[model samples]
Target: MPLSEHEQRMLDQIEQALYAEDPKFANTVRQTNPAVHYKRSIVQASVGFVVGISLLMGGMILQQVIVGVIGFIVMLACLLWGLNAWRRVAVGGEAAAQSQTKGAEPKQRRRQQRPGMMNRFEERWRRRQEGDDR
Candidate 1:
């Protein structure tokens, strides 16, 4: 549902007050991009994965089983972390594209119409289990 004119004005006033109270903080919040954060996470994970590979190789060269196991664990953790960040970025990008295409539609309305991430994942899992390639 669209906001009433009075509600919109009130929201605008509140936002203005927030900016007035702390321009720097408000600007920082406005400039922050979640996608950038996710991308940074991915880069960090990639670096950690490389470190893990080096550790694994070093362990093998030094004949240390414990070091090798630790390296494998680190590799697995970084891989999972990177994949999670990638999925978040993909989902967020898709939502942004959809919102742009939708023009001025209320975000609440769009959210209600769209399936949640978990629902989409569950649906995909079901399809895979059923051998539906599509």
Candidate 2:
């Protein structure tokens, strides 16, 4: 179902947050047009399997049952190729999860040291050293 406008805005916000969080993963997801990818894989696989069946039937008409059987096995294997193709392109969905990972983000600049406890400790130590110097 299509999302309502409100839901769509919400989704957009979430997507922006994700992109902000992890541009690399967002790029990966954008690389795949899933519908086109899946359909091409399925169609190619189906055509291969179908051609294999046609060859099998032609062999049977030639009274070459052994050849026909071999062709049929090949057709089965080609049909399985469809599933394999789908698997190969199926990782696009994981981009959402990747967006949650801080480390997955592409590098910009290195992070500046924050004014956390470590900074505070360093500041205190520096003050003591300066006092000793004086």
Put down candidate 2 lDDT per residue, 1-134, tens digits, no spaces: 47999999999998999899999998888786765777798789899898889879988899998879888987998889898776656644456446546554533233343466778788889989889533
- Candidate 1 deviant stretches above 4 angstroms: 1-14, 93-134
The runs of at least 3 residues in candidate 2 whose Cα sits more than 4 Å from the true structure, single-residue gaps closed, are 1-35, 86-92, 95-134
- Per-residue accuracy of model 1 over 42-134 as CA lDDT, tens digit each: 999999999899889989999999898899899999999999999889879767767777875677687789998999999999999999969
Q: TM-score for every candidate vs. truth?
A: 0.60, 0.40
lDDT score of residue 100 within candidate 2: 45
TM-score of 1: 0.60
